[model samples]
Target: MLARLGAISLSLSMILLLSMNYGSFALVGFLSATGLIALVVLHPWTARLTDRHGQGKVTAAAAGIAALSYAAFLACAHWKAPAWTLFPAYALAMGSSPNVSGMVRRRWAHLHDGSTRRAANAVEQVADELCFLSGPILATILVTSVFPEAGVLASGVLLVTGMLLFAGQRRTEPPADPAAGRRESSPLRRPSVWAVLMPYALVGILFGALDVTTVKHTTSMDSRSAAGVLLSMIALGSAISGLAFGKVRPRSEPRVPFIVSVAALAVLTCVPLAAARLLPDSLPAIGAAMFAVGIGTAPVIILGTSIVQACVPEARLNEALVWPSSAITGGNATGNALTGWIVDHAGDSSGYWVPVVVGPAALLAAYAGLALHRRTDDDCVAAEDVGV
Candidate 1:
């Protein structure tokens, strides 16, 4: 949660500063996407090293690199650096950060199984929402009260502190398995993998578009400061629903729930567009819309994560888990860039369509995953019964 707090804080926290520096929404989008691209580039490699070396050593090293990157960011802010310098530093900051959240999920999978693991994942999903729940609010307070650089600086401190403590828990850590490194096939070879990750990427788009859209909308109302609080409303709804959703164990495969949740997400996402159009002057209405839209978030996420966990081999678990995250990163980059462009061209409220448009694609991907998983499961079940 701390790790996600640091990562999520970046865009909103430094947003005003980036606007001051670049003076263009498009540039901000490019820079944000660039940073996420760096993260995507490093994910697979980081997972491989974590598998080969051990989570503690690899996470510690990544955290250290992230610290240095933050230091570089601090230096740039001090000097009032140009976009060229700030862009790369921000990219490095994002790229170098450890996959602490991913590590946590992998650990959960390592430590638990079956329904226990599902419940654990559900709880962890709530925790993930909590990180996001507080992250933006914290970033807003620090940036508004302290300084623009405070958010990234705080992120650095939290990243270093949390990762070190987490790594110290040696007994719970998944043991290093160098032998699995010799496997000939890659998890990427499976089509089901794409089925899972594609929706994740779509979900990423939802988040990214929502981030920029809310901020821009609030900014339009001359309440830019309230952006964090409004965003938190969305997170609050997700966390609340997540707690309730976590209690009920699904009696069947997650396919139906996953698809239904994704479908709900796509439909609810359109509410913001309506709110923006009808209640242009009403912040309360807009906030309610955001909260309503957020209801579908945790269910889609928890189900997706659990399904993906079930799909992959234990040996490649870390790597497999990281892929959904990377897909989200990639989707975020795309969403940010696209929505940023819309804000620049169309207007902040019109930018609401970005998520609306992406929603169906996400739903379609979830449906495809449900179909693929069922087919594969049926094939396996048939073979097993015949063998018996």
Candidate 2:
């Protein structure tokens, strides 16, 4: 239920905000960037609160605050509120971003062991992708068929309902640790945590570039209506890949998937550039290529996440997980903002270049990490022998 609430809130809010005034690309970009920053800033506090109090209490509070924020946004919209009022309201709504994935992962780690834990993590990843795909379409229908504000209101309702249900579940809430206080004192001081996170930061940048570039490219080629479809295709592709990957048996070296996924993504990146050259004037052709590109996204994300989960200690798992989320959000926000500026000043031709540059850079980062892993394989052998 916590996961469901988080998904609904995030999906509904994104679709409503993006679809309502997508014509104003600059404003959308600015709001997304700022909102992501606000969320990233609040993450540590959110994690700390959950650790100290409980996942239930923290989740309930965040959901309630998020619901109120949505309500305020609706009221502001009704009253023709200026940017000053709306901006804060928007930031507040986004800032209450739920740590649903992290929370679930922690719970899974606590309840399960060995291969079961890995399977649970993979299932969660697939679920995340599923939510991303379904959430937007639901939001799109609500906003377009009913009213724009309706989407926001619906988000609040879903958030409240899901949170209440989740909070009621005994097993869903994590068991309280006697040493929780000491454990939370200084999580980031560990070197292994940083080792797991550093590469993800670079991957996050690539994801961000891909997300914004896809949005900008589709909107330019077709219409704002097409943006939702394009985004949906990407999510759908990822969801399918994640589901398939999750069902597979565990391998001796999980990094094999990680390496393959990143390589595929790098190669797939060229598809857009090819589309730009070969079908320069064809929207349909570009959309097809975008969909194919989406196919590689989920596998890369899931594999990378699996690698991180395997690398980190159980105690530091939650803290380590937060970095990837923060990195992705930060990357997406920065990439969208930068791409928006480039498109505005440099013309549509500049949009294709975003992916072209980011793709190779991300691939290089992944390979470099892989190289480091190989060099340290002898030392890691004892660790891997134990089986995470």
Candidate 3:
């Protein structure tokens, strides 16, 4: 959660600085995409290193590099460096920051299995929502009240501190096998891998679009200040539901979480879409509907993490884990661009359609991969044993 908070806060600050320097939203989008692209491209290699070396060793080293990269990026921005320099510097900073949330989840899987793991996943999801809830607000406050570069500087400190603290937990850290990558083939070869990741990516679409639409909705309503309140409803509902969802033991059926959450999402995502039409100008109605939709969001994530854990060899788990995140990052970028265009051309309310469409696509992906999900039982099983 600290990693998420730091990464997001830093992204927001850099975005603001870029906006100040360039005065072009297009350039802001480009730089943001560059950072995300570096994450998607570089994380697999880092995860592989984590599997081969150790989480503490690998993440600590990477975080150190990330902190230095952040320093360089900030220096460049502060000195009013040329427009093109920001993209590469920001990309390095983003790519080098450890995916600490993934590492933490990896640790949870190391500690628990079955129902206990489910509960742990819930806690992580709650923490994640809380980070999302607060990170942007924190960044906005620091940038506005303190200084233009204060947000960037603070986020770097938090990230390095979080990684160092997490790394120091030597007793609980998972043992890294130096030869695992050599012995086990890459998890990327499994066709069912995409099956597992695609649904989650669709979930990302729902979330990414939800955020953009929420802000746009507030803007259209002529109450831009209420945007944070509306988004808080969604995050608050998800966090509450996540705590409750963890207590409900999932049945033995393998596809239960995968199929069920997507189905719920398919139905629940429509609530906001419906509210946008039925109560066009009612912020209370929209906020209430958003909270309702948020109720179904966390389970999809909680179980989704569990499903990923079940679907790959423990030896290759870290690398396999990065794929879902890559998929989500890409999906979020897609959802943002797609919905932003709609908000600009059609209407702010029309932005909800992207999620509505994305929900059923996820459902289809869930069912389409049921056989694969059911057969993927023990993560420790040899990678070669997972049949195509």
lDDT values, one for every candidate: 0.79, 0.63, 0.75
- Across 1-388, the per-residue lDDT of candidate 2 in tens digits comes to 4345344445335534553544455665676677777777787667766666777777777877877887887787656666557667877877785666787787886677666766676688777767666666666566666776666677667766776666566666666444665754444553333434555565555555555555566556655445545556656777777777767754556565666777787777677668867877676766676667767877766655555566555555565567667767777677667766776677664666777777777767667667666655432323243233
**Best candidate per TM-score, number?**
1
Candidate 2: list runs displaced more than 4 Å.
Answer: 1-23, 77-80, 184-187, 214-222, 280-284, 370-388
lDDT of candidate 3 over 55-174, digit per residue (tens): 989877887898899999999888888879887888899899767888888887787776676678789889987876677667656766687788898889888888888877889888
* Candidate 3 lDDT score at position 25: 42
Between candidates 1 and 3, the one scoring higher on TM-score is: 1
Tens digits of per-residue lDDT, candidate 1, 161-211, equal 787777787999998888766872465765556767878899888878887
Error of 3 at 252 (Å): 3.5
- What is the TM-score of candidate 1? 0.94
The candidate, 1 or 3, that scores higher on lDDT is: 1
- For model 2, where is the 10-residue window of minimal lDDT? 379-388
Which 10 consecutive positions of candidate 3 have the poorest summed lDDT?
379-388
lDDT of 2: 0.63
**Can you list the residue pairs that collide in candidate 2?**
none
TM-score, candidate 3, is: 0.86
